[model samples]
Target chain A: MAQTNLLSPPSTISPPTALQLSQKAPRIIANPPTSSLPWPLSLLFSAETPEAWVTHENALYACLRTHDDAAARQLLDRLSARFGESNERIITLRGIYEEATAKNNGELEVVFKKYEDILKQDPTNFGVRKRRVAVLKSLGRTSDAITALTMLVESSPTDLEAWAELGEMYAKVGEWARAIWCAEEVLLVMPNSWSAHAHLATLHYLSTQSSPHLAPLNLSLKNFARSIELNDSYLRGYYGLKLVCQKLIPLLSESSSVSKRNQDEDGPPPNLETVKKLEELATSKLAEIVRRYQPGTKEWQGYDGAEVIAARELLNRDANTER
Target chain B: MTLLQTAPKKQTLAQIRQQRSLVRGINLRTNANTLSPSSFQARKAYMVSAYQEGKFLADPEGRGKPRPNPMSDPAAMEGMMGMMKGNMAMMVPQTLIMGWINAFFSGFVIMKLPFPLTPQFKSMLQSGVGTRDLDVRWVSSLSWYFLTLFGLQPVYNFILGSNNAANQVTQQMGQVNPGAGLMGPEQDPDKLFLNEAENLEVLEHRWILDGVEDRLLARTAG
Candidate 1:
C-alpha cells in the first residue's frame, strides 16, 4: 500500500524541517495516528513534497489508510481551499473523505445521497459521477454501479480509466463476456498499451475458467505472447504465459481424455511441438527476469510485489520437482 | 555536420493520420484488378499505414537543403537588431541613470554595504572613494548599482509586463533559442504530410493477435 510516497529512508531526513529535527516537537512520519494533531496544527507538521495536484489524492488515501481522520480532514480542507468548495475535484475528494471516515452504512448512504444531489444539479460532473459509482459499489449496489459505469463509457468511450474500471466491475460480477468487451473497448482506445494486452489475456483466461466447456485457449496464449512481444519488460505477460503453458502442457499430453477437444482435422493449430516451444520460451524469459533483477534491487523493485513473488514461487516449484 | 548521413523527416500526429488514409487509398487502387476478398485480406492496409506514418517526426535538422544562417545575411541581422530595440530601451535608461547617480554619490559618501565583500572587489568598487586601509571591505555606490541592475527584475516585471526589459537573462536566453518567439514561423504541413506518405509504402504490419486464440487452444487440447 502506497500510503504516502513522501516518507523517506529514516536516517535520510526528508526536507528536515524545523519540527522534524527537534526532539521536543511531535514530528510526523510515514503513518501518523488518527488524532495525532489537530487539523490546523497538522498542516505545519506534516510535509508532503510539492508534486502535481493529482498526487494529493495519494496523500489523502494515505491518511485514510492510517485511519488518521484529522490529517485526512485537514488534507481535504487544504484541497478544497486551493480549488474552491464548488470545484468538481473538491466534491469528489470530500465524498472520498466521507466514505473513508464513515462508521456505518447509514453514513455511506448519506454520502451517496450527497453525490446524487450534486450529480442531479450538474450532470456533466464526471469526477463526482465516478465517485458515485465507487459509493454505489461500497453500498453493495453492483448492478447500479455497472449501469452508471456503462452510461459513463457510452458518453465518453475514449476514457481509458473508465473502461478499465468497467472491465474490473464486470469481472467481479462474473460477467466474463462483458468483461472481455470492456477490455476490447480499452484496446480500441489505446492499442499500443502493453498492460492492456496483458489485462485482456487475463480476462480471456478468466473467461475460459468461467465457461462449463473450455473456450479457445489460443486467444489467451496469443494475447500473452503479443503483450510480451510489445514490451519485453512486461513481467505480468510472461508470468501469465508461464501459468497458461503449465496448464496447457498436461492438456496436450492427454488430449484424448479431455471431453471438449478441438474438432479440426488439421489436428490442433499449434501442434505439440509448438506448445513445448512456448513453454520453454515463457520459462526462459521468466528465469532471465528473476535472475537479472534480484529482489530489493532497483530493477526488481520496478516489478509488482505479488507478481515477483509469484514468479519466484513458480521457479522454485520447478527446481524442487527437478531435484 | 556529417555530409554522408541522411536523416528522416519528422511529422505531427495529424500528418501521420492523413498519410495513413492516403496509403490505404493507394493500396486499394494499386490492387484494384486482383481485389478478391482473400487476396485483399492478405495485406492489412490500415494497420501497415498507421504504425509507419510519421514514425520519424523531427528526426534530424539536415535533410537536403542546408539550413540558413541568420548572421551571414545583412538583411536578417538588421531585422534582428530592429526586433531587439524594445528590450534595450528599458535597460539603457535604467543603466544610464544608475551609473550617473553612482558616480555622483560615491565621490564623497563611502557607505558600508549590508554584507562583506572580498579584498579583490574593494579595489574595483572603492576606486574613487575614501578607504586606502583594511577598511576596504566597505561597499561604494557602484556595488549598489550592480545589485539593482540585476535585482530590479521583479520590480520591473511588476511595473511593466513580465516579458519586459528588466530581465536580460531571459531576453538573452530567448535570443539563443531560435523560434522561441510567439509568432516566429510554422513548419510546412503539406511537406510534412507528403514525407509521411512516402514513409508509409515501405512499412509492414505484424499482427501478434492473428491466430493467437487458435494457437493457445491447440497447445492445450493437443
Candidate 2:
C-alpha cells in the first residue's frame, strides 16, 4: 500500500479507493520524512526521498476527492513551502484547492476570477489556463469551455491532453464530425496510441447510428482492429472490436450489393468469413480477460475493476442474444 | 577533469530549458495559423505531394537552407566560451607538467620491465635518456610520465563511475564539435517539422489482428 501510494495518482479512482487513500492522507502529511533540525544537521539526517513528494501530491488529490478539505490544505501548505508559491505547478495546485473548497457557484466564480488574473499576468501559464477551463465547465457553461479549449489547442497543438479534452467536449455537444476530427488529430500526433485508436473507432461507431452507412461501419471496423493490433491485452480495444464485428457481420451478409458499389472508394469491406473470424477472436479474448480479471489475480490487478465488470457484462449480453 | 565536467553539466541543464521554450514557441506559431479547416486541407495536400515526391519542399522563403554558424547563437557562444576556458585550464597544467619533467627528470631511467623487450622498443621506452645502447626494457622518466597520463583513466573510472567526464582524450574530441547530437544548432526547425509530417504521411497502418483468430484457436487447443 505504501509503495503504491508513492506512484502518481490515476486519472479516475473508485470511491472506495478514494476513501481509503484519503484516510491515509493525514498520516502522510503529519510525518513527512523531512527533518526539523538546522540546515547542516538536517541535510545529514533527513530521510527525505523524491518519492515522499509524489506521495504527498497523490495524498492531496485523494483528500480532495474524498472531501477531506483540512488534510488537503495541510498537504498543499507543505508543498507550497517546499516549492515556493511562484512555482507554476504549485500555482495550479493552489487553484485546484480553491476550486475544491469553494462551497457555492459564487465562490467558484471567485476562484475562476483568480485564475483569469493569473493568466492575464502570464498568458503562457497553460496549467492555470486548463484550470480556468475546468472552472468554466463546472459552472454549466460548456460552450464557453469549448471555445476556451479551442483557443488553448490553437496555441499548443502538441498538447495531447488538450486535444483529447477538446474531443470529449465535442462528443458531449453531439458534434460527431468535429469530435472525429479531433480524435484523428490525436492519432496524427501519437499514431501508436491504442487508446486514441479505440476512441476514434468508438466515435465512428456512434456516428453510424445517425447516418446508417456501411462506410462508417467499415471505418470503425478497421480502427478497432488497428487498436487491438496495437495492444493485445487491451480490454477496451477487444470489447470495441467485438462490438463492431458483431454489427458488421449481419450488415455485410444482408447488403452485399451496397458493399460492392462502395468497394472501389472505401476499400473492400471485410468478407463474411473474415468478419466471423474476427468476431470469434474478439469473443475469445474478452472471455480470457474476464476470467483472469475476476479473481483480482496479481498480474491482472492492473486492470480497473469497473472496466473488467463492464467487459463481463458485455460477454454475458452476447451469450444471452445467442441463446 | 572536474573543471571540465562542471561546465558541460550546467550548460546542458540550461540548454534543455532553452530548447523546450524554443519548441513551444514554434509549436504555437505553426499551430495557431494552420488549425482552420481550409489550412488543414492545404497541409494535407502538401503532405500527400511531399510523400509522393519522397522529399518535402524547402521553405519558399529560403529560411530552411544554408544554416548560419551555430557560434552566432548566444547559447552556443556561451557553451563554446565555457569549453575554451576548461580546455585552457587543462592545457596549462599539462604544459607545466611536461616542462617540469623535461627539466628535472629527463635522463633518469625510472623503471624496468619484468619481461624482456625487443630492441625495437629502445627508442620508445628510453625517450629522454640520450643513450643509444640502453637496455630496451628500461623506461625513461619522461616515458613513464606519458604512460601514466594515458593509463589513469581506469583509476578515474573507479573513483567516479563510468560516465564521469574525466577522460581527457574523449573530452578533447567532444569539444571539437559541441552540440552535434540530435537537436543540433545547425538543424532548421521548419525542415524538422516538414520531415516529421512526411514520415507520418508515409506510415502505413498494417493491422496486426489479421490472423489473430488462428493464433487464439491454437493457444486454446494447445
Candidate with the greatest DockQ versus the true structure = 2
Task: Supply candidate 2's per-residue lDDT for B167.
Answer: 53
Candidate 2, residue B36: lDDT: 27
lDDT of 1 at B99: 73
- Give lDDT: candidate 1, residue B75: 57
Q: Which lDDT tens digits does candidate 1 get at residues A239-283?
A: 888777766666666774453455432124344566677777778
lDDT of each: 0.61, 0.72
In the range B20-47, model 1's lDDT, one tens digit per residue, is: 3343334433432222122233333543
> Model 2, range A42-140, lDDT digits (tens) per residue?
766877777888888888888898899999999999999987998888999999999999999999999999998988887777899899999999998
Fnat for every candidate: 0.10, 0.03
Stretches > 4 Å off in candidate 1: A1-57, A210-215, A250-268, A290-298, A316-323, B1-208, B211-222
Considering only chain B, report the TM-score of model 2: 0.60
Residue pairs clashing in model 1 are: A217-B217, A218-B212, A218-B213, A218-B216, A218-B217, A219-B213, A252-B222, B10-B57, B10-B58, B11-B57
RMSD of each candidate? 14.4, 7.6
| DockQ score for model 1 | 0.06
